[model samples]
Target: MAFGKSKNRRRQDAAQTKEAVKGAVRSHGPGLLKAILLTGLTCAVVWGGIELRRWALSSPTFLLKETTFSGLQRAAPGELLKLSGLTVGQNLWALDVEMLERTMAAHPWVRTVEVRRHFPSSVSVEVSEHVPAALAVLGDLYLVDEDGEPFKRLQPGDTLDLPLVTGMDREDYLADEAKTRERFRQALEVARAYAATEPTKRERLSEVRMAPEGLVLVLADGTEARLGEGDTDAKLQRLSRVREELRARGLSAGVIHLENRARPGWVAVKLSSPASERSGASQ
Candidate 1:
């Protein structure tokens, strides 16, 4: 009987230990499942981000479709577009903006180029063209800009009614920009002064020829005015006074020398042909 009780007791202990292990698993199973699901979600998010990036980089939808242009006045849009060498279907990522800018720079009328990409759809180009300040005669007529840059040769179709600036070779102007620009500035200054006159008076100034001594202003009536270097404003003031006096006297001159530094109050005028009277005036 004692041996029988001992075996039964061992059986009871083994059964109790099995029940305890089942209870522990029941308590921890939900927490372990939650931890595994969270880990899997993080992995899926990382994988999705990577795939999206790859798709965007290789997608055909991110192509150059439309091209818009601005700040283009004198430059032809078709010509500038050709200069850029851009096509509608080019991949935006592979577009070489710097090369396009360099190509645009090669255009004679283009002063500056700006190229931009509109993501997923289009491209834009802004071109600043060289603006003509005067017509310079350099073997042939050319459009000279404010910065002393002569950009384009004058075509027969171009307008002919602009102030003429002469006396410098095109190659010489291009070779020495600094020196050429200073000379150009002086000539431009003379034009500005003349342009300030009354509309009818200003229209009479047809040419501002650069001279070894200074400037020679030629009128439409074949009258010439000698404007020596410096004191441009003072000289113009004196010229105005002389013009009033001449108009009062009903006199037209072939040439008028106004570089009257010695007698700042006086002007010398030579009469036109078929007239014998040479005259002088005091302001």
Candidate 2:
């Protein structure tokens, strides 16, 4: 009987110990939660204070500390800066770099423009100014690039020294892209081909006409070469060969025609055989 009573006592003691452990954990749960809350609040306050201090120390506006311009030969730095809408004491993030670049590109002389910010305070502008291939004497004094793309037009002045293209002037050249593109391509090809020739020949070459049949190259001395539609490469090659032969054999000819490859035609030599200034007779 005594043994059974002791066993009952031991079982009760075990149950009590298990309840005590559960109660201890339950009692400390709220305190543990409170400690965690206090720690999080302290961290939040410290973080907030740090942020406030940083905000106070930083400048309200990202002022322009320095300005740089590159690849701008004809364009004045001051003028371009003014046009860019970027100035000292302006907010860095507020500036629209892309819009500014686009605005600058609208100027006829500017071929390409890039605007970038040097964090905190500086803005740098780089522009590739248009090297005018020729001045299209259209209604507007359009400046044509080497690719014959009419980028911009303005009143003529000291800034440009390219050749003048005067023919079939129109106001809608820029708007009528299809027609203009064709004409521009032809002119570009002719100009490039002429440029590849000897210096004397290059100097003598005047204008290229985009005719319906093909392209016609008019020289400074009133002579013209007719190249049929397409296959300009072959025609230019023939002209070069014929020119070299004429120079080697002591001959002068007018209107060297590569229009018909089977039988190349030329006007008779008009001036003295080897005189420097050899003029060709009109056909």
Candidate 3:
């Protein structure tokens, strides 16, 4: 009788376990199916994206048909195109824009460049070329831009009638590029100040010499105006007044010294006299 009762209890426990398992399956089966479906959908989307990219890369519809350029002054359009290595019928999507820009920027005149792809068939490149401001004599003459960067070497047939900047040593430039650029900038500032003040005689302005004492402006007529550091505009104004006065008096000055540290707001003039030297200070 004890053995039969034990066997009956074991059968009841097995029945209960089977029912619990069925209930658990009923609760979680739909969730498991939903999870599998979501996984499949994500995989399909990724595959579709990859295939689309592959098709676009190999498609003939994206071939380059035309290339255009703007803001080009000194750089030739054909040369720029050649430098970029972008030919018609090449795959537009295959072209690396950054690499093309770097290649085009290697041109001496290109200061800034922007390359863009117009969808389906075209590409455009916009460039900003350096504007020649003055000529810098650094061993070999170079064309200095408005920002005081010597961009291009002065080659034959490039005849630009601009102010000449002197006293910058090539060795100094080779040793410290930043210092040389700063010095060039200071000289350019003085030249620009003189041009603004003396517009009528702007063409007569020839050389801007970066002297150790300060800056010296030499005119085409061999007149020298010494301008010490600081108060550039005020000193230029005083020099302008002195120049008008001298012209009225029918006199020429060989050296107009406005840099007198001993007496501020006073100008000393040396007349262009071959016989005798005369010096006078004016308030």
Highest TM-score: which candidate? Answer: 3
lDDT of 1 at 246: 68
* Clash list (residue pairs), candidate 1: none
Clashing pairs in 3: none
What ranking of all candidate models by lDDT puts the best one first? 3, 1, 2
Give a tens-digit lDDT track for model 3, residues 104-148. Answer: 999989999999999899999999999998999999999998888
lDDT tens digits, residues 175-268, model 1? Answer: 8978887887788878788667625754367778888878888877787888877777777777766666667988777888877677765678
TM value for model 2: 0.66
TM-score per candidate: 0.76, 0.66, 0.89
What order do you get sorting by TM-score, best first? 3, 1, 2
Judged by lDDT, which candidate is best?
Answer: 3
Superposed Cα deviation of residue 56, candidate 2 (Å):
8.4
Range of the 10 consecutive residues with the lowest summed lDDT in candidate 1: 195-204
For candidate 3, the per-residue lDDT at 13 reads: 100
lDDT tens digits, residues 1-283, model 2?
9999999999999999999989988999899899999999999999999897666446664666787889988778777767766677776666788888987777656889988888777888889987777767678667787766777766646575554555546754756866785687667767677767635744456767666666777666655667756667766766666566666977544566556544434222332233444323222
lDDT of each: 0.80, 0.69, 0.89
